[model samples]
Target: MSVIAVLALDGVPGPQLSAPGLAFATAARHHHPVAYEVRICAGPGFRSTGGPAPFGIDTPWGLEGLDDADTVLLPGHEGFRAVPPPGVVDALRGVVERGGRVGAVGTGTFTLAATGLLDGRRAATSRRHTRELARSYPRIDVDPEGSAVADGPFHSAAGVLGGVDLCLHLITQDHGEVVAIETERQLFLHLHAEAEDTGGTTSGAGPTSGAGREAAHSALADADREAAHGALAEAAYNAVTPPGSSLEPVTRWMEANLHRPLTLDDIAGRAGLGVRSLTRRFRAETGLTPLQYLLRTRLQSAQRLLERTDDPVERIAARTGLGTPANLRHHFQRSTGTSPTTYRTAFRAVVSGMTWPERPDGRP
Candidate 1:
């Protein structure tokens, strides 16, 4: 099992501190074999801001607990601008030096940035603090628009629920997409039900149930059994024949023919269905119309080309069937918030240790 140490400091926000533990616990409740061992660790005098009401928390582990952790996480806190206590920075640096991953959520990125581990790396923090973070840490690349960003082994997330996103991403990296999706479904359902019961909105708030608190343990053993049984039954059915929507083959064809100037009628004919039937089923299965999927695929192809090759904008637009450089620029910027040239320049700078050049057209 992977050991995750959540470093709780004085004035740490309650939601951010507990979100990772809840997420990992939810995953353990669904997986057959438990995957994570999560611990809340802190040094002396550790307390939580408790939102508007201040409170104190006692943990079983201290800074020593982080020594053997596979991952160390720092959650947002009130003292984000204040330097960490003596030895805290050293402990964080030690984790990275020993090949362990480090992550932060919201203002916690400020703490991580203060350690200098994120210098020269892209990081995401709460948008509200973006300007202050950038001003404070001139070397760290702060991306205000990013909800979550992973640069090498260092990860950062924005907002309160951003911790859940970060945890889900980590779970996906450790397990597979299937496990991550299942875990997310179970957790979201639990949170949603809790919200409805309390007459609260089902926003990306942290979990608030006893089950949620004990998620990393055996609290949901029965639910895990039922989920496992259901999965086994599904797998048995899948063994007899492949499972998925009829649109699967059509979607695959679309991926293969992204460079072609395809239309809805062509897709419908290829799927052997009338346009209306094709549209309904495609939306049901893929959550997108055929044309939307096509556009998204082309944009993804264009992004890959920009990242991997030095292809000019017009050539890439032609190759991806985007038609013209201006069209590609409009759509690409709408989708990614950066032009092709700027995106390519930033990506190359990161991957190849190249410096970003000044372009007369104001591209990065």
Candidate 2:
């Protein structure tokens, strides 16, 4: 079972902390035996606004509690500055270096960014703070339209209420779509409005933050412009699939070995199938050739890093096994049809509701 620790700080809105805990608890209770152990780790002095009614709970652990966790969650708080407490920042950095999943809820993203773990990563916090976040962390790509954004092991949300969406996403990632969807149904979120909407403005289309959420939504529309408007309905449907970890052994192996430069022969030998048979089965199951799937998978990881972290292009290339920054630029352009810098800028502007100059049209 995973040990999930939520880092609680003073000033966090009551719902921001409770939402994820409640959602994760619901997910844990589905089985006869729970799949995770969850706790709240209090940082600094334990005090919360709104008194005992909303912020009444006491924490069982302290900052040191994160050391024993497989995942660490930071809930949203108000009054964040360009800099956060050194202890809080340092603790979060350690958690990520250890390869533990570290997530932030709503304005909690400010704390995560202060840790420097998300320096260049794409992330979102409460829409109310999007401008300040972008101004403070110019390198980080802030996605407004994204209710919740996941990059590598770091997850972030745009509002306190969005914590529910973030939990659902993680549940879907850890388990399967069927399990997550069932959980959502029980929670009365019968559909993921963003995933199901055509015009992108369905009933639940805008976030609870209203104008702030709308700004982010506008950015999302621009980011997805190439999809031919409402044509995205079909594509979004196709994009929804079971979690990657639950697939067959060979597929799981591919996911595990992504950091290595692998060939068809390497995968086939491990899967105990001939090259031809493996190719046939893979195509039948995933509808893509082995090489195509590998490329897509690698690109997906690269995109997440581009969105979530400040790692240099060279480092991202090496980690994703594309060989060099040049290789990354080449393939990234071909796949996404935009340079990483432009992608980041567009995303930030949308989330911040700012306008940027047009790209050079090669005029004399």
Candidate 3:
């Protein structure tokens, strides 16, 4: 069996630590025993700090626990007030050197990046830390807009809850697209299973939903968190298309032609429906008109490109069908409350480092 080790820091989030084991464990049971063997390596002790629960527990193994694992995960934790302990950094470095997969959830990416493992690699963390990341780690390409990032053997996720999305993506990469989809369908049980499957959540602080999650996150409120993140994953999955609807064909066409300038008439013709009928059905099923949905998806793609690539805003505007850079910037600022350049500079994770100009407001 391939071993999967979860490395938990002293103040790691509880849900973040549990997420990998739950997802992978469930997957292994439906598949095979040889599929995975998961273990929690508490560095030196099993402890909860800055998590849902508070208490330190003991572990059977220390950093050596990761020595031969197939995958090593670092769940999200509070950022360091000082340099990482020597043992933690050494253990993480060893895992990568031995060809084991390495992953971090949320601010845990800081630990991995600090180890210099992510130097010049594409990585991601929660959006709140985006600018701090760019200013702190200059060489690493931190993808603020991405939910998950796989650079070589290092797999990094946005935040605590993003652990689930990252794990699902990892399964797809390790197994196949079919298995990944099945796992996603199962993971949706927490929210609205059997509603629709959009796919996964984007990168940021753990999702903003659920009483337990909010209470656990002293930084955010419970009601606000649940409402914000409650629909996101479902939206991602259901955004695929409603079953038994003629709109599926049109949806696929739109996704395929995101770079093309599309009009409602063009979409209606492709779906073999009139403009009025298409609009009505699209709204009834997807809760979005074809144009509205198209704009949102295009914006998402544009955001990703801005963070992960060196391509200019003008070029990204053309690819995402947003037309001119000026128009793209206007919409981007309106939607995300930040400029494209600022967004790109903050969330991109780097090991080598880059220079970030000080904001007039003095943010990263």
Candidate 4:
């Protein structure tokens, strides 16, 4: 298990302090292999009985608590304009020196910037502070439009709810794309407050603050969007297979490792079969050759990322094992008879109840 220490300086923003633990727990719940010991550390004189975890720490660990942490998170606070205490800055730097990551959210970027760790690095902070942060730290590159920025081991979030995006990015780095999607789905299901006054006009990340990029919305109801999500996910990675199928294990493994350059022999080695037999059996069961299925899987992954995320095509291509943007575009246009951008736009409309036009050959 890894340790994630959240150091709360004086005047800690309540939401920023709590969001990381929430995102971590939700990720763990969705994917059992992910486990983290979250420590909510605070400055001296901090004490709590019922804190984030069930067994609250009687004396919240101070900067010393970060010594064993794999990731030390800092939340924005009231005194963000003032430089962090010397001890706090030293503790944060120590975590980086030992090769751990450090993340800050909202105005917390200001606090981290003061440590000089952000010098010559790009950072994201609250929109209002973008100019000030740039002016204050002349060496740092402040991204005014980005929701999150990761430079080396340092990550920073721009808006208050950008914490969700930052945490999701970390989860993706630690686990994989599929796990991050599942965790985002879990968070979406648990988000309750829609709108009390406007009959549901919530407006965080397309009306779901916890949605991040995976659960980004269409013009559908929550249930409908979830159904669409399930359908897409099932098609992309989890087509139904009969019990005791010979290729079940290999197919599951293929879905998990779509980002890898998998050939028939490599997959056959995993399934303990010869190349010919693996190809013959997989094609018989799935109606596509082993290589064909692999390409299809990669394209599906690309499509999911394109539709549900704000990530650039180049990043999506890399994540989906399409290798490069040019390669992804080549395969995507050939397979769908439309460019990736066109597919994303048309499919989102389809999910919103718009019927897709028939193909040139009159096929659906």
For TM-score, the strongest prediction is 4
Worst ten in a row by lDDT for model 3: 350-359
lDDT of 1 by residue, 110-212 (tens): 9899888899999988889998999999999899874668898898878546388778778777765545644554454355322111111122211223553
**Cα TM-score of candidate 4:** 0.55
Q: For residues 1-364, could you state the per-residue lDDT of candidate 4 as single tens digits?
A: 8898988776665666678888888776444346778888875433332223322244358788999999988877767898686688888889999999998888889989999999989998888889998999899999987576889999987744537777877777787655565455445434532221211111212212343323322212232333343433223321222345688788778777765555566778999998789867865555444665566566756766655566667677666666556667766664445566665554544332312233352212
lDDT of 3 at 9: 76
Record all residue pairs in model 4 with backbone atoms less than 3 Å apart, i.e. clashing. none
Measured by lDDT, the strongest candidate is 1
* Runs off by more than 4 Å, candidate 3: 32-34, 44-46, 160-162, 190-364
Model 4 bad stretches (over 4 Å): 44-59, 159-162, 193-249, 252-364
Error of 1 at 37 (Å): 0.7
| TM-score: the better of candidates 1 and 4 | 4
TM match of model 3 to true structure: 0.51
* Residue pairs with backbone atoms closer than 3 Å in model 2 (clashes): 120-309, 120-310, 121-307, 121-308, 121-309, 122-307, 122-308, 144-216, 145-216
* Residue 42 displacement in candidate 3 (angstroms): 0.9
Evaluated against the true structure, the overall lDDT of model 2 is 0.60
Each candidate's root-mean-square deviation in Å? 17.7, 17.6, 16.7, 14.6
- What TM-scores do the predictions have? 0.54, 0.51, 0.51, 0.55
* C-alpha lDDT of residue 125 in model 4: 85
Ranking by lDDT: 1, 4, 3, 2
